[model samples]
Target chain A: MTRFALTIEFDGGPFMGLQRQDHGPSVQQAVEDAALAITGEQVILHSAGRTDSGVHALAMRSHFDLEKLFDPFRLMEGLNAKLRPDPVAVTACEVVADDWHARFSCVGRRYRYLIRNRRAPLTLTRGREWLVTRPLDAKAMHRAAQHLVGHHDFTTFRSAHCQAADPVKSLDRLDVRREGEMVIVEADARSFLHHQVRSMVGTLAMVGLGRWREEQVAQALAARDRQQLGHNAPPDGLYFLAAIYPDD
Target chain B: MTRFALTIEFDGGPFMGLQRQDHGPSVQQAVEDAALAITGEQVILHSAGRTDSGVHALAMRSHFDLEKLFDPFRLMEGLNAKLRPDPVAVTACEVVADDWHARFSCVGRRYRYLIRNRRAPLTLTRGREWLVTRPLDAKAMHRAAQHLVGHHDFTTFRSAHCQAADPVKSLDRLDVRREGEMVIVEADARSFLHHQVRSMVGTLAMVGLGRWREEQVAQALAARDRQQLGHNAPPDGLYFLAAIYPDD
Candidate 1:
């Protein structure tokens, strides 16, 4: 058996998310079907992050085991060809040890949220970006974001449907910046509670809108209640940027 | 009669360009209909540049005359509300002299083109960007662009069906820059021929791909023949960035 790692990119708009579901299409199912078409074999693929519906991934790495010997790069090319019409691509493929797991072997994950802050409706990025009609204060959002960086119980930010065993996790970084009419929020952590990033962004938007202060974020964190947090920013604005590993 | 100068923004994916055409829906028609919906009168609108279909506009300035004393700002808001689901917006409106014309009064026009140079098939920006699979040398493209920056007949870069009376036009600036996997080409001029920018980009792309040399661009221009140029690029990646005019 050979274990192979693949770097993937996908537009999650039409997908139910990274994982396969009974009702609709998924990124994983699309890739698996493509692989089946190329190799005529059924296999389960493991991803570094399980992104929700409407989320996008610039580079999401995954791994799977195949029972036969095949050229790694050719497999990737073949899989991509079969995956056409679906907004998903397998960019890289490399042979790895069987011990390597895409999810367990990962050290951290990075996410980016893009907000088109303008009056005009996004035509090209309609389903890909979050549009905010009101101008946001990036400085205030940045100040409020600092309160969430570090080890803490993120109960207020966690989704009620979150399956994480614990709410306490270390957030290594959370930065918010604005470029022209775009508001960008970048976050990195070893792991995250379900909907944590979206929840935080929704709350930070209130701060950016001058409806909430920086200290309010701290109060929400201490509340340990999901109801204390702001709305969930749409999944459209979120992207699973990358997953970091210990070695190349 | 009162002349109203308005700044517009639109997603050019659905229309045949900025100009009204006999066949398809146009940005001009959409805006004009929106205006007519609010004022209950027929009005003629003029634009700085007549962009082609699939091109976007960040700021396209235009003007229309109205006999009704409707508040220009309020009318803009009303028109925007009426143009919903079409991805058009009237961002700013002000009263101007009756002689003001959206097209004739413009001193310069700025345009931006986006080329996504990556191996992955575009997932998010399918209709919004030009996806070039070949390796593009932006430096070579930038160096070659300088040859067409100054005053030139630009016959090679103009469309065969262009209705311009004269081919001689001064190009104020032409810049090619790289941002991540995207190549950006920015151009500014008093005006342009029908398909000039798209034609130039198509030729520059040939240079970037090593199919054409830097000197080839000059030779094509000096040839003073439309057949000497490369193919006309699609309108997907183009943008009407802004139209500059002197203050009242």
Candidate 2:
């Protein structure tokens, strides 16, 4: 048996999520179907970070085992060819040790939230950015985001449907900055609670809009109650940037 | 009559072109239909630059006349609301002088062609960029591009169906640069013959890929023959960036 790791990018607009689902199409299902057609083997792919519907991925890492002998490069090329008409691409593929797990061995994760702060309705950039008509102050949002850094109980920022075993986690970084009319929020951590990034970004947007004070984010985190959450941003603007391994 | 100037943006994937066509929908038709619905008067729309099918626009300048009096801001908001489900937006609008003309009064035009240099097939940027699997040397392309940045007879680059009165025109600027995996070619001129920008970009790409020598572009220009053109790039990556008026 051979284990292979794959790096991929996908547009999540047409997908239910990264995981396979009985009710709808998914990125995982698309790849699995392609593999079935190419290798005649039903392989279950495991991804480093699980994403929600309407969330894009720039470079999501995944792995699967194949009992049949094949070249990794051929498999990657074949997958890309077979995954036609779907918005998914296998960027890099390599043979890995049997013990190397895409999810378990991952050491860190990164995410970015994009807000198009403009009066114009989105044309070409629709579904890729959250449009905020009201002007936002990025510096204020950055100041508020700093309060969510470091280890803390993130219940106030978690989704009610989150399946994580614990709410306490260490957030390595949370930074906000503006480029032209775009307001971007970047976060890094070993892991995250479901909807954590969106919740934090939504709350920070209030600070950016002068609806909440900068110190209010810290207060919400200390509350450790889901009901105290300020806001939950839509999934359209969130992007899973990368999965970090020890070697990377 | 009230003359209103508009700065609009659009994704040209669904339209035939910016001009009103006999067989297909157009950006001009969309705006005209919306304006007629709002004011109960037939209106004709004119734009600064003419775009081909599958070409997008960033901030295209246009104008139209209406006998009914209306505030510019309200008209903008109404047009945006009326042009729903279509990938078009009016970013800015204001009243213009009676003699102002969208096409004739324009002093300059800018265009950018995007080439995504990567092995993987695009997902999010599929229609917005041209994907080139081979590595491209943008500096080499830029060096070749400098060969076309002045007054010259551009007959080799002009399309056979071109309607321009003169084949010789001044190209104020032709520059190429790379941002990460995107190779961008930006062109500025008072006017361009049909297919000139795409033709020049395609020739420059040959130099970037090492398929043609650095001086080959200059030779192609001097040949003044359409058959001597290296390549005619597709309209997918071309963008109408903006129209430059005297004040802008």
Candidate 3:
């Protein structure tokens, strides 16, 4: 069987999540079903990251194997055509070495979270951005975010539902900045515990809102207790930006 | 009576247009209805520019008058609360001079058109941006757009339904730039004839695609004939970015 890697972009609002689920539809099920219709092959899609419902992705990498070989461009076109009416697009597709895996081969991952700091109700970007009515001190949020940049036992930020065996992980970067009414937070790491990013963002927001002091973020991390978590940001504003590979 | 000026932002995907229509719903109708419900009096909402069906607004300026006066802050918050689930927001509201008019007092209007030039189907920004599946040379498009700037008779670009008495209007700027996979066209003018920006952009796109020479834009303007127009772009990508007033 030939292995193919696909880069996809999707609006996760209508999806149950990125992974296939028995509960409802997912991005993986949508693409796998589309592949079945095109190539008459039932395939399992393995993505680099498993996103929760209501989370978006700009370029999430995934891989699958097919018994029949097809040109990457034609395959991409056919997949996109078959995935119609669904808010999902296969932006890039290519053949990969049999040993290259979409998830296991990846070296790093990136995510971006957006907050619209305003009192006005959202209109244009309703499901795409989180609307926060309170004024956010982005500089304070940025300073607080620095406390989570290095390696740590992030038990305070890990979700109770996380399936990862270890609570300790290395966080490469976490930066916050404000642009007009938007407060943007960008994070990078080799891998993250489920809900870690959201948990961290929610805690840092307390600092921006002047509720939690800057050093409190460090204290929360050291406590390493889920109940000690400040807050957990909604999935509405989070986006799986990209997945990094060794050769890429 | 007290006059109030409002700055609004709306997603036009659900509305027939910005103006009130007998056959369908509109942003103006939504705001007017909200105002009537709030003040128990019918008030007409006048906007700086009349947008076509499926056109969005980032900061459209509008005004309305009411016999019963309410605090500007209270009025704005109430309107936002009443306009729920309609994708319209009163971003700002303030008391204005009785002589001030939303349409007449505006000194300039700004518009932005976005085109996603890619083969992939749109997911997140379906109605918010136009999808064009052709490779466009933005530099050529920009050069061609320059031909339509300055004072000119724009009969070729004006829609047949245009009610403007004269087709001659001074266009201050028409710029075309490429931002990654998107081609953005920004137009600034004292006023524009119906369908002027879309018509000009459609004609300029031909030059970008190598179908029409750069001089064709100038020749089309000189002809001043509707039949000479190359194309008319769709309304999905057009946005009333902002209304410019001389005072501030």
Candidate 4:
């Protein structure tokens, strides 16, 4: 068996999620369908991140096993042609070892969340970005986010349906910066619980609004209770920016 | 009568064009309907630029005369709210003299066109940007554009459907620059003949592709015939960036 690793970019607005669903279109289904069309074989793809509906991915990595030896570049071209109008693209394809797993082999994941902190309604990027008419202080949000970095029990930021065995996770980096009328937040972690990034961003927004102090975030993480966090930031602004793999 | 000048921004993907048509939605109809819905008075709006279908506008200025005095800011807010979920936006509004016209009073018009030159398919900005899979040499294109940036009869670059009385027009600036995988072309002029910018870009693309030399563009302009030019660039990448008005 030959394992093929693929780097992909997708607009998740039309997808139900990365996972296969019974009723709606999904990124997994789209890729699997394209792979079947290209190789004439059914394959299950393992993704580094299972993004939710309305989320986007710039460089989401996935891997699949096939019995035939096929050119990786040709696979990318064929998959792209079959994907059609769906906004999903196979950007890069490479042959990997049979032991390689897109999810388990990933050492870290990077995500970017965008907030248009202005009064003007979004005309060009309405569904692609989160529009927060309220003014946000990026400095305040950045200062607040620093307290939550490093190893912590992230139960307060985890989703109720999160399937992780433990609430403890290590957040390697969290940075918030402003560009023009937009506020961008970058987060890096080995792995994350469901909705963890959104919850953290939601709490940071309170700091931006001057409603919560920077120390509040540290205290909430220590509490490890889900009730302490703010609302979940919408999926529109959340993007799976990249995934890091261990160098052999 | 109160003459109100409004700044507009819209994603023109769904509309026929800026001008009203008998079959499809137009930017003019969208704005006019919004104005009438707010003020209960029928008014005519004049725009600085008449953009084609699938073209976008960043700050297209327009003026309309109303029978009643409505707070310009309030009117903008009302129109934006009543525009429903459409991509049209009334960004700003101010009262002006009755004689002020959006197109005739404009001293200069600025337009920006974007082209994403890369092998990868566009996922995030599909309709907002033009995608070119082939590599383009921005330096060559820029150098070639200098030959046409002065007072000249631009018959080679003007569309046959243009209604302008004279083809001789002075170009203030024509700049081409590359930012990452995106190539941006900015042009400023008192006015432009129909499809002038698109035609110039088409010929410049040939220069970028090594199909035509830099001197060929000058000869094409001197030919002063529409057949001398290259293909018309698509409207997807064109933007009515802004309009400059002389101080009263």
Candidate 5:
């Protein structure tokens, strides 16, 4: 048996999310079914993280083991062929030691949130970006974002349904910048609570729009209460950018 | 009557083109219908240039006369509201002189073509880019593109159905550059023959793929025959970037 690690890219508009559910389709089910069709063996695929509905991934990492022997390139091609008509693609695949894990062995994960700051409605990037018609003070938002860059109790940013054992997590970076009409928010961490990035971005948006002062973000984090959260940005603009492992 | 010049942006996936078509929907029809619905008067929508089917536009300049006086912002907002569900938006609007024509008065037109140079199938940007599996040398393509940048009779690149009186047109700029995995081709000209940009891009792609040498491009242009054309790229990757006017 060989363990394979796959880097995936998918449009999250069609599926329920990355994880399997009884309610609707998922990126996991699509990939697992594709693997089953190729190997004739049902395999459980594990991902680095679970994304909500309408959340996209640029290079999500995942892993699964197969008893059948096949070339890595051939396996990737076969799976992509079977995933046809669906917005999923296996961009990269490689063999790894059985001890390697897509989730537990990961060292870092990065996410990018896209916001289109404009008065006009989106045309080409309608579903891909969060549209904020009101003018945004991206510089002020960036200044406020610096307050949440280190380890802290992120309960205010954690979702009510999050299953993390503890409310504390080490956030390595949270940077915001404006690129043309897009206000990009990049977050990095060793691990994250469910909906943590979205929750933080939602609160920062309030600061950007002048609804809250820059220092208010620090106060929200200090409160350590979910009720103090400003809002949860929609899933349309969130993207799982990459995952880093020890081997890299 | 006031002639309002509007900067429009649209996703071309849903419309036949930017002009009124007999058999299918077009951006012109959508705007005209929206205007009629708002002002209770028939209006003709003229665009800077008529884009082919499935060609997107970032900021296409156009003009239409309205007998009823309406504030530019109100007209723009009302038109966008009525253009519901359509992938079209009026990004900017201003009143212009009666003689300012969308097509005739346009001094420069620019276009951009996107090509994804990768082995994997596209997911997030499926319809928005052209996928080329083979490796491309953007530098070589750019070098070969210089051969077409001056005054020339571009008969080989002209479409058979092109209505331009003379095949001689001076191309101001034709640049090819690679950004990460994307190969972008930007073209500029006072005016262009039908399918000129796509045809040029297709030929440049041949050069990039090493199918045709840089000199072969010169040879094809010197042939002055449409039969000598290498290929015509699809409209999927083409975008009307912007239209330049004299007063600006």
Candidate 6:
């Protein structure tokens, strides 16, 4: 048996998520089905991050073991050929050691949220970015984001359905900047509670819009209650940027 | 009556073209119908550029006259509301002098062509860029583009359906550059024959792919025969970037 590590990119608008579900299609299901058709074996695919619906990914890492031996390039080409019309592509594929893992061995993850701050409706960027008509103070939002940059209980920012054993996690970076009419928020952490990035971005948006003061974000984090969260940004603008592993 | 100039943007994927046609819907029809719904009067729209089907626009200048007085902002908002479900937007609007014409007064036009030069299939930019799997030499392409950047009889690049009275046109700028995985071709001119930009881009692509030498481009231009043209790129990657006027 051989384990292959794949770097995948997908426009998550059509899939339920990166994980498989009984309710609808998913990126995992699509790749797994393609693998089955290629090797005539049912295989389970594991990913570094599980995204929500409407969330995009630039380079998601995943791994699966196959009993049949095939060239790495052939496997990639075959899978891509079968995953057609699904808005998903395997950009890179390579053979990895047996001990390497996709999820458990990952050390960091990064996400970016895109907000189009404009009154005009989006034409080329529709369905790809969150459109916010009101002007945003990106500098203020950046200042407020500094309040949540250390180890703390993120209960206020986590989803109720999150299954992490603990609410405590260290945030490495949180940045907000304006690029013309777009406001971009970048977040990085060793790990995150479900909905943590979206929750943080949504609350920071309040600061950008002057609905919440800089200190108020710190207060909400101290509250340690999900109900205290100002907002939860939509999944449309969130993108899983990259996953960091020791081997890479 | 008031003459208002509008800066419009559209995806152009769903419409037939910028002009009104009996066979199918168009950007002109959409805006004209929106005006009718708002002011209860028939309105005709004149644009600086008449883009073909599948050609997008970043800011297309246009104008219309209306008997009903309207605040510029209100007119823009109402038209946007009525042009719903279509991939079009009125980005800017202002009252212009009665003599200001959308087409006749335009002094310059700029266009940009986007090509995704990579082996991987496009996920996020599908239908928005021309995907070429072959590796391209952008520096070589740029060197060849200089051959077509001057006064010339562009019969080889003009389409058979072109309505221009003369084939002679002054080309101001034609640049080719690579940005990451994408190659952008930008062209500027006082005016162009129909399909001229696409044809130039197509011929340049052959140079980029090492199929034609730099001098062959000059030879093709001197041939003044459409049959000698290398290729014509698809309209999917074309964009009417902007139109320039003297008063602006």
TM per candidate comes to 0.96, 0.97, 0.99, 0.95, 0.98, 0.98
Candidate 5 lDDT, A137-175, residue by residue in tens: 999999999999898999999999999999999999999
Per TM-score, the best of the predicted structures is 3
Worst 10 residues of 1 chain A by lDDT: A118-127
Candidate 5's displacement at residue A149, Å, is 1.6
How many clashes (backbone atoms < 3 Å, residues ≥3 apart in a chain or on different chains) does model 1 have?
0
lDDT of 1 at A112: 97
Off-target runs (Cα >4 Å) in candidate 4 are none
Candidates by TM-score, descending order: 3, 5, 6, 2, 1, 4
Per-residue lDDT of model 5, residues B130-193, tens digit only: 9888999999999999999999999999999898999999999999999999999999999999
lDDT of 6 by residue, B81-102 (tens): 8988788999999999999999
Docking level of model 1: medium
Interface RMSD of 4: 1.3
Candidate 1 segments whose C-alpha is farther than 4 A from its true place: none
Q: Candidates' lDDT values, in order?
A: 0.90, 0.93, 0.94, 0.90, 0.94, 0.94
Residues B1-248 of candidate 3 have per-residue lDDT tens digits of 99999999999989989999988999999999899878798999999999988889999999999999799999999899989989999999999999999899999999999999999999989998888888999999999999989999999999999999999999999999999999999999999999998899889888989999999999999999999999999998999999988787
Off-target runs (Cα >4 Å) in candidate 5 are: none
Which candidate's DockQ is highest? Answer: 3
Q: What is the TM-score of chain A, computed separately for every candidate? A: 0.98, 0.99, 0.99, 0.98, 0.99, 0.99
Q: State the displacement of the C-alpha of residue B145, model 4, in Å, after optimal TM-score superposition.
A: 1.9
- For model 2, residues A81-123, the per-residue Cα lDDT tens digits are 9998899999999999999999999999999999999877899
TM-score of 5: 0.98
DockQ of all predictions against the true structure, Cα-based: 0.55, 0.85, 0.93, 0.66, 0.81, 0.78
TM-score of 1: 0.96
> Model 2, stretches more than 4 Å misplaced?
none
Residue A40 Cα positional deviation in candidate 5, in Å, after optimal superposition: 1.6
Write the number of the candidate with greater lDDT, choosing between 3 and 4. Answer: 3
lDDT of 1 by residue, A29-74 (tens): 9999988888888989999999999999989999988888889978
